[model samples]
Target chain A: MNCEQARPLLAAYVDGELDTVRMLEMEGHLPACPACTRAVRELQQLQQSLRQESLYHPAPAALRRNVLAELSAQARPEPKPAFWSWFRLVPALSGAMVVCLAALLAVTLNRPSGHEQLTAEIVSSHIRSLMANHALDVVSTDQHTVKPWFNGRVDFAPPVKDLAAQGFPLIGGRLDYLHHRTVAALVFQRNKHIINVFLWPGSEKNSAPSLDSVRQGFNLIHWNQGGMTCWAISDLNPTELLEFTRDFAL
Target chain B: MEARERLPAFEQTVLPHLDAAHNLARWLAGNDQDAQDVVQEACLRAFKFFGGFRGDNPRAWLLAIVRNTFYTWLRQNRPAIPTVELDDAALEVADPAAAGEALQTRQADAETVRRAIAALPVEFREIIVLREMEAMSYKDIAILADLPIGTVMSRLARARKLLQKQLAREYQTGGPS
Candidate 1:
């Protein structure tokens, strides 16, 4: 592998694309040939420097909001025609049918018990927060700032800790309406992902945290700790979200 | 599937590559505002044709649309200027002056490097950005740029060499007095 033969293949060798035979051939020539070795080193250094360069520009938050809003607007279901006009023609029969329907609805709406309803509420709240660009009402990472910010907004103080060293940094907190009452939503960051931890006072004693359910690619973990029921939801993988809840439970 | 059903799949698979698409568009469009426009256009197009996208590489798929959208944008907005054509013959001939100064000790600043890249012909600039900055493989870049693998390799080599020459010139001019 003279310099001429080796020069063209140096880029490939640096990129780790060469076959084993070619790699061995290049390795054999590098010790004996100073110029080829330097060329290979230069290419490697150039590639490394380029990778380390901060050249990637992220899409602005406004762009993300705009794109999501456009998609949601397009996906909204069309409204059905009015049923009042048809019912007006047969008022006496309609009144009796409405009474029967109300009785049936009372039974059907009661089907989802407490836990299932809470799971659905938290999941929808997470999705709405993301889609509406309202993930955090107060944006601060300091646990002191975030924890105190929840005062006067919600009845109970949500525990806030900076788990940044553990790869889950506290983002901030927000007041969210869930379970027919106001709850504290302490937001956290896992890389670019957002995790919403909803906290409200619980009547029952402490219980072990466990995976509650998954809906629309978001995972939910429900647990009771120190007289508070915690529901943490995120699109982040289940294992990581579990680890997060475990850290919070401690 | 209904459009609403498809929205979740698109958000899970394709929306994550927004930064990658924006970065490529930023380089191709040469400014942040134009880049945003190009990326938004590309994303809408990607959503409309997402049913046809069967490949696993969502980033590459999104970037291909970005590249196409940028070219269409350039054609419509900057129609008077001809498409840049690299002089392969000239690039093949080595400039001995540049070759000698290329091994200088002085380092080029980030500004110099960026200016040099922005100064290159769009053809060279895009290939360099894809291969060097984006760290894409030759095959993926070829698909994105719609060029042969051999062409991609040769173009990248030339682009790097041109960058080195530009850096060498900066070093010679701005070295410690």
Candidate 2:
């Protein structure tokens, strides 16, 4: 490859993304080409100097307090009745089954199903929405203005309400889809925790409000309110979430 | 009892990374105060979604949030970038030539390089901070910056070249001397 061709691959080469053959070819060109060789040396030095500098500094004490407070404020207890229900059924199923059948049931219960993975996928959607600039296309507290902003963006208007009087102030509304259907995420804040309330119209009775807790240390509360299903995910305590939900739902 | 016991364990695993989160925030936001706020907000958001994080690298996960928070704040505030007027009184001495000599002598030390790195443009400073201070892989930096990995690599190359040139000018003029 010519210098023009080799320039772009240089970065991939440094990053170890190139295959063996391409890496060997780049290495061959490096020795003969002064510019390519200089580029490699300089890039290495830049990487070294950056690694050598002090990047990780302790946050101010007050800042840590602020973050914790924000977290504590939004945390609410998730409904874990489903897990208990499932566990409760496990013992009953074993007692009724024959000894041979009991062994077969054990293998089935241990494996994670597609529904559990769906929860992970939903949380990922939440993370990506906040990561990208699409958090709120129209930033406002006016329900009339924020609710209409989703028009033409999605198929329906998400229920936007003003809960500021309840201490969970309305930030704005945005269009988001989850669980193979168009969903509305109404953004609100209790102190500093931006609560993401995912809403979708469903008639399944919301499955008795189950709390799915991940072993990696995240919490999710899925409940059915009115005609919509609400999945409240946050790092807050389940008790805190329950309190917030009780107040917000009222 | 089960829920009560889980909180402390989760905190122990995740809270320790707060400082590293703040440092990346400081670099992205370009100030101590904004850095504090941005990192705090990111922490809350990360905690809320902590369930989705799985068992992977928490540091990288948290840093990505901090980086995103800074960009969000930057867009909201749209705060005017305070220009580093080289025309300041402390920089301007009786003799134009003496300033150069003094900068060189004083800047040869690592401390000066540290300060100089902070004084670069936001784009330049971010690349320097991510590459040097954070020791992030180019791919990681690209992912965090929302740029292609190739752009991250080239930007680092240019950032270093500019920083070195700036240091040379500062030192060669004897400003730090």
Candidate 3:
């Protein structure tokens, strides 16, 4: 690959967007050509500075508040008219409405694999739990306090293990509603990321050996163990999240 | 589904990406206040079309809306600034040490880097921000930017080329902050 052939691909090469074949060809040509090497280094540095610099502008708190308020205001349905409430008392119509609701519930709950809806629910639960004063129902680093805290609140004792020595410290536990049931959410901190581990008794349909998915940039991994279905979701990278699951299960 | 019914899911899948949207909008619209307006308007548009969002990557989906909203606002509100500014001073002989200056001084301040990026043409600026700052893959960027994969790569290359020259000049001259 000479300069003309290589120059067009040089940026892609530096960006690591080149396919393996093209990348290796660039690799072979780069060291031999000083111009391309300089170009490559410059591009790499530009990319580095762009990434490392604090350039990301988070929406202002006021903006966030206003946007949500605007959405809710726009989405808010007007109050139903008085006649609609009176009409609902008609027996046959009310019976049909009940059937319509049941059908809607069935269709909503019986998603293709149940995973899609459940994943969405889990992600929302994770996000909702992160809100201030909602993350923990009982704050404790001791497994004793956290594990038993779920006993009466939820149907089962969620397995609570603190892998603080492994870099995932037990933070606390919260009750989160997901998958049509209230489940115990065990919270842990891995550096800056909060990992939410949700557990409930597994029904026959949703249990799996292990599964991994990425939803809205959050990493989620779930599996069944000891008759309990467990989902661990966080912003942590997959490898560490997998490690977290392994350590938690240990 | 009605907007009221879909709002919760929208908050879950779409709203979480506000920072990403704001970051992109901030770069594209050129100021925080304008960016907020763009975000607010884009999200309202997003809610209007939320029923059609079937993809899994809501961040990318939200970003696409933000970009489109920004362009529409740009068309209506502001006269087009020269999208491409060829730096005539960039004709000076390339400094041999300039490429390495980033490593040496880390040679620019954070503000300098931010200004350098902001100064890039929108075509180049958006690509660099998405690739470097948002950390999106080229494929995702292609989808978000509505460009072919090849275009995404080449534009990124060209953007970096211009940025390199610009930064090198800034460092070598210690150009005005």
Among the numbered candidates, top TM-score falls to 1
Once model 3 is optimally superposed onto the true structure by TM-score, how far is the C-alpha of residue B150 displaced, in angstroms? 3.0
- Model 3: residue A122 alpha-carbon error in angstroms: 81
Writing each residue's lDDT as its tens digit, candidate 1 over B1-177 gives 667777899899999999888888888888988999998889888888888889989998999999999999999999998876777775763542335344433344566677778877788888878887777899999998889999999888888777767666665686431
Better candidate by lDDT, 1 or 2: 1
- Model 3 spans with C-alpha error above 4 angstroms: A1-4, A29-35, A79-250, B80-107, B175-177
TM-score of each: 0.56, 0.45, 0.54
> How many backbone overlaps does candidate 3 show?
0
RMSD of each: 33.9, 36.2, 36.2
The lDDT per prediction is: 0.82, 0.67, 0.83
Considering DockQ, where higher is better, how would the candidates rank from best to worst? 3, 1, 2
Candidate 3 has a DockQ of: 0.30
TM-score of chain A of each: 0.57, 0.48, 0.54
Error of 1 at A219 (Å): 90
| Candidate 2 lDDT over residue span A201-235, tens digit each | 76645354556564244467777767677776655
Model 2 bad stretches (over 4 Å): A1-19, A29-36, A53-56, A60-250, B1-13, B81-109, B175-177
The fraction of reference interface contacts (C-alpha pairs within 8 A across chains A and B) present in each candidate is 0.37, 0.42, 0.59
